[model samples]
Target chain A: MKYTEEHEWLRVEGDLVVVGITEHAAEQLGDVVFVELPELETQVAKGDEVCVIESVKAASDILAPCDGEIVAVNDALSDAPGMVNDDPQGDAWFFKMKLDDMSVLDDFMSEDEYKAFIG
Target chain B: MAEGGQNGDLQRTVLHDLHLDLGAKMVPFAGYAMPVQYKPGVMAEHLHTRAQAGLFDVSHMGQVILRGEAAAAALERLVPVDLQGLAEGRQRYAMFTDERGGILDDLMVANRGDHLFLVVNAACKEADIAHMRAHMDGVTVTPVTDRALIALQGPLAEAALAALVPGVAAMRFMDVATYDWDGAALWVSRSGYTGEDGFEISVPEPCAGAFARALLARPEVAPIGLGARDSLRLEAGLCLYGNDITRDTTPVEAALGWAIQKVRRRGGAREGGFPGADVILRQLETGPERRRVGLRPEGRAPMRAGTQLFADDTADTPVGTVTSGAYGPSIEAPMSMGYLPAALSATGTQVFGELRGKRHPARVVDLPFRPAGYRK
Candidate 1:
């Protein structure tokens, strides 16, 4: 698993990368009321905004970590956005991305590095 | 993101340490470090307020005393409420109008027998004080800095508060009374913004924390933060000073005409004596071009404030703009308040709110999304 400065976590599963916001980010957002996920199969570049998370306080964007194509999205989030707050790191994974170069994941921060970065 | 960088410039209320102890997420509001939510978060706090009781630290709001024998008559020259007709121990909602018929600030005026007690918005208090002092003569506008204001609101508010002050149980909605608690004189009004049966207690600054802790000691009462307070008021269809009603919005346009009594209207005994009487009264008779209306969006996604409303999906120009929008925890739906042209402001009218470059359908509804639980 790898983390980005934007507080998103990426885990490699076979050839796909599952993306979701970290528990710290979810805790900061309080309660998630809505989540606007990207369309399946949409191509996105690094740093491009891919999803929008709306909490009771305000709305925030989840940027794409690397150049990839969205392969699958968690439709359950559309029905129960609160799941993001309940299980941000586990079942609340936002989407699965097919990265063009799998080696790009090595450049991201490790779990310890991300924790220190948040501090 | 939470407020920082200007920490030195922000002020703290009397309950600051208490909020910190309760694990409140403090945020900057109107130049004060106010708690936006406690450990329960906004959703739970909102629901808790509706289900039981929620104590709010509203000390940041400006409390003032208008003294002298001619205070009521002098105040009549500013707001459009029937101040003279207001009986002692009663309060009325009023707004100071500008020369252009726009609202300068909205406040609560309570007749305290010896003087009038006014509670104005925190952001507009300084300007409101200056405006009152500049216009009204023979009346002393004394800013009360030694008092802290706290509101206990909910369906069980009376039960929780009556436990502390037995006299509060006898007070009806909008009734004001003075009571002694722990050697402190508490000026309490049976009024709140949550549309619930509640009381706003003005306590001496030194004892404010103890008073709040006493209320919180009750099983029905919990400390709610500014975030839940906002959502509760929004669900109740009440206006935030800077949001729903502004200096550019009039009483009629903001659907606040109900607050203006007949005695202050056209052809009444004390008509046209207040500021912007010409335009406000004219709008009162003929109606304004735009009107504030409640909205229910079609989806779970909230069409937040500043979202432009159009007549349809393809309109080039917006017909209105959302002022307050949130997911109402009690109502279990996304509700909003915004302004629209009179022709398109009817209930059930279809409108489109542009969000994320897509036009989402929303229906125009009546002012309050939920029924008020006032004890009146």
Candidate 2:
């Protein structure tokens, strides 16, 4: 798993990368009430807003960590967005994207470095 | 800026340290460092208030005592409410209107027998006091800076508070009484911002911490923060002074005409003494062009303040603006309040909210997304 300064995380699996916000971001957002994901097959540039996460307090934009083509989105979030707060890194993955360039992963932060950056 | 005490040098409430000690996420709010939420978060706090009781540190609100033989009459000059008929031990919601029929600030006025007790918004308190002082004579507007205001709100509020002050249980909604608790004079009112049966207690600053602790010690009571407070009031369709109702909005346009009793309306005995009487009364008679209404977004995306409302999904012309909005826990959806043309203010009128550059479908429903659970 890798993290971006925007608080989103990506886990690479074969040619696709699963994306979701980190636990720290989820905690800061309080309870997740809604999640809006990019449609499948949409092209996304690095740092592009790929999704939106709405909490009880405010709405936050979720940016893409790397250039990719949106492959799949977690349909379960529409019915139960709280899954992001309950399991941010697992079943709560926002979308799966086919990476345009795996080399962009080099810019991502490791777990320890991400924790230090947030601290 | 986030809602804790953010912008400049922040003031601390009496419960400031207690909030920090409880691991509350403090933010800037109305020039004061206030808890936005605690470890349990806003959703839990909101649901807790509806199910049980939640204690709130509303000490940032300004408390004042108006003392004089002409106290009620003097107050009647600034607000449209019929203060003369307000019985002793009862409180009414009122607004300080400007000469142009715009709201200066919304406040609570309690007829405390010999004197009237007033609670105004924290952000506008200083200006409200100065406005009152400059406009009125004979009555002395005494700002009670030494007292801290706390709200014990929810369904279990009565039971939780009753355990501490046995006499409180006997009081009905809107009732105000002074009680002696732990040797301190506790002025409590059975009213709150959340549409729930609750009490707002004015405790001496020194005893505020201890008093709050005592209430939190109850099994049914938990400490809530400003975040939950805003969400709760939004769900209740209660206006936030700066957000929902502002100096640019009139009582009629804001749907707060009910606060003005019939005695102050067109043909009443005391019809036109208040600040914006001419325009307000005219609006009351002819109706305002735009009115505030509740909006239920068709999707899960929450449309926050400043989100523009369009008459159609094409989103060409803007018809209104959302003023206060949040995901109401009890209502289980994203609810908002906004100003719309009176023609479009009917229940089930389809509208669209422009959020994040996209138009989301919404309906102009009745005010209060949830039914008020006040104990009358």
Candidate 3:
């Protein structure tokens, strides 16, 4: 697993990379009230804003970590956005992206580096 | 959510230490390091306030006393409220108006028999004080700095508060009185920002911590923060300063005409003595071109402040704009209030709020998404 500077986590599985926010990001957002996920099979760039996360306090955007096509999205978040706060890195995984090269994940921070970055 | 850092210059309220102890996320608001939420977060705090009692630290808000025999009459020249006719031990919502009829600040003016006690918004306190002193000749405008204001709000507020101050239960909504708390005198008002049965207590600075701790000792009471307070007031359809109402928004346009008593109207006994009487009175008779109304967003996503409203999805120009918007915990929906053309401000009117570049459907509902539970 790797972490992006925007507090997003990426994990490689088969040909897809699962993307979700880190626990620190979820905690910073307070309570998750609404989540707007990206459409499936949509092409996205590294800096493209693909999703939106709304907490009780304010709204925030989720940026794409790398060039990829969104293949799957967690539809369950629409009905229960609080899951993002409960299990951000697990069940709250926002989307699965089909990346051209999974090796791009190596450029992201490691788990220990991410912890120090947040600290 | 970025936890706010303690800015060295920001002011700290009397309950600052207590909030930190309760695991509050402190944020800088109106020059004060106030808590935005506690350990339970905004959603839980909001729900808690609706079901039980939530204690709020509002010590940063300005409290002032207007003395002299002509205080009420003098205050009448600034606000549209009928302060002169307000019975002793009662409070009324009021606003200071500018020459252009725009609201300077909204306030609560209570008749304390010997003097009028006014509670003004924290951000506008300094300016409001200056405006009062400049306009109200012969009346002494004295700021109360040695007191801390706290609000115990919710359905169970009365029971929880009565446990500490037994006299509060007998007081009706909007009523004000002073009671003995230990060795200190507490100025209590059966009023609050949340649309719940509650009390706002002004305790001596020294006793504020003890008073707050005592209230939280009750099982029904929880420590709420600014985030919940905003959501609660938004659900109540209450106007927030600098948001729903501002220096550019008039009372008539803001749908605050109800706060202007009939006695101060054009045909009443004391007519048009206040500032901006010419324009405000005319607008009162013939309705303003634009008016404030409640907006109910279609989906789960909140139509927050600054979201533009259009008559249709394809409209290039915005027909209205949202002022205060949030996810209302009590109503379990996204709620907002904004200004729209009088023709488009009716209930059931369909409007589009532009969020994230996409126009989503919203309805122009009546003010206050939730019915007030005040103990009248």
Across residues B49-167, which tens digit of lDDT does each residue of candidate 1 receive? 99999999999999999998889999999988899999999999999999888999999999999999999999999999999999889999999999999999999999998888898
* TM-score of every candidate relative to the true structure: 0.99, 0.98, 0.99
Arranged by DockQ with the best first, the candidates are 3, 1, 2
- For candidate 3, write residues B1-376 as lDDT tens digits: 4567766899999888999999988889999999899999999999999999999999999999999999999999999889989999999999999889999999999999999999999999999999888888899999999999999999999999899889899999999999998999999999999999999999999999999999999999999999999999999999999998987889999999999889999999999888898989999999999999999999998999999999999999999999989998878889999999999998999999999999999999997899999999
Whole-model alpha-carbon lDDT for candidate 1: 0.94
Chain B TM, per prediction? 0.98, 0.98, 0.99
After superposition, candidate 3 runs with Cα above 4 Å error: none
DockQ of candidates 1 onward, in order?
A: 0.84, 0.69, 0.84
What are the clashing pairs of model 1? none
Encode model 2's per-residue lDDT on B1-376: one tens digit a residue.
1333233589999888899888899888888988889999999999999999999999999999999998999889999999999999999999999998899999999999999999999999999999989988999999999999999999999998888899999898999999988988999999999998899999998888999999999999999999899999999999998888988999999999999999899889988799889999999999999999999999788889999999998857899999988899998999999999989999999999998888989998887888888878
Model 1 spans > 4 angstroms off: B1-5
Could you tell me the C-alpha RMSD of candidate 2 in Å? 1.4
| Alpha-carbon shift of residue B153 in model 1 (angstroms) | 0.6
For candidate 2, give fnat to 2 decimals.
0.82
Q: What lDDT score belongs to each candidate, Candidate 1 first?
A: 0.94, 0.91, 0.94
